[model samples]
Target: MMSQKLAASCHCGSVKFTVELSEGGFDTIRRCNCSFCRMRGAVVVSAPLTGITVLEGQERLTEYRFNTQQAVHFFCSVCGIYTFHQRRSNPEQYGVNVACIEGISPFDFASVDVTDGVHHPSDGSSGGVVGRLLYRPVEKDK
Candidate 1:
């Protein structure tokens, strides 16, 4: 599929970035059922590290690290939006927050695959192989 470029930004527009989508669209969005991800409840799409360019508010971005610390999450200090993160499973790619991307909505996906991140192999804990398939249908106006 042809790659497509999309612009993303924090809730307050403090941090802005552009990402190139290899899948061309939201066809590859996913969710991780890990402690951090589960709590944030974000849908993410992956892109090569080079595919992302920080256009603004670099200094205002804050990082969060834990556990293996391989996966570094970046959020806007102002609006506290989780814009993107370095993937733990694949450090070569970044997981861009789908909600931050312009002109796209999480409700656009018919189903999002939830990875069993709670049982991530790096944690050395036996996280079960179970996965959850989630679907959120948008409610129409009355």
Candidate 2:
């Protein structure tokens, strides 16, 4: 897919930004079973390190790291919402929170690949999908 730019922000709108998706665009979406990711629970799409530009509330952004501390997770301090993260698997790219993207929702995807972050590849293990998340929207009455 062609590269595309999308607006994104935290729940409180305190952190506004733009993300230029990688060549795969939304098709790069996936989830991780890591301790932090499992708790934050955000579906993510891919973007290069330079692809994201924070338009506002730069100071209100906070970062968190765990275990290997290779991946840096960013969130809106004002509303405490996960916005994106530097990928441990690929530091040159980021895994942007799909929910933070305008006009997009985590439920929009039918199925998402769940990577085995518990046994991270960086730790010398062959990381792979452990499961899949399925979204089934209910039918509405006419």
Candidate 3:
């Protein structure tokens, strides 16, 4: 309410996160009907990737990506909390869980345009990712 920083955690509180957000962007929930989302019951309220910051316990998290690993899903490895993910559709956008963050409720659900993830896997052309070897010298680290 008074504080702008939204604190969030897994159901067991093994993992915690904070979002430094602008005044109007906070919401109750966001979601899509894609097979993965439907199964997980995830609602994503997205922001610029730079907006959210993992305050502590980066090592306690796990990543998951399907079809393409570009959209990295970061969750609490201990408690299995679905915190956030890199948007495969818009890799530049940070897909955050609306329920994960503390404070804020659902924005206007009627205006929240849902995407048909069932048809389209992602917005990227081919989920192209460059290898580090392309940039690094051809030598393994000692």
Better of 2 and 3 by TM-score: 2
Q: Worst ten-residue run, lDDT, model 2?
A: 1-10
Instruction: List ranges where model 3 is wrong by over 4 Å.
Output: 1-4, 21-24, 27-29, 104-113, 121-142
Clashing pairs in 1: 119-127
Q: Residues 23-132, candidate 1: write the lDDT tens digits.
A: 54566688988899989989998888888899999999999998888999999999999999988887888899999999877777777878779878666766544665
- TM-scores for all predictions: 0.86, 0.95, 0.69
The TM-score between candidate 2 and the true structure equals 0.95
What candidate 1 gets wrong by more than 4 Å, as runs, is 23-25, 123-129, 136-142
Best by lDDT: 2
Query: lDDT for each of the candidates?
Result: 0.85, 0.93, 0.64
TM-score for model 3? 0.69
Q: What is the lDDT of residue 119 in candidate 3?
A: 57
What CA root-mean-square deviation does each model show from the true structure? 2.6, 1.4, 16.6
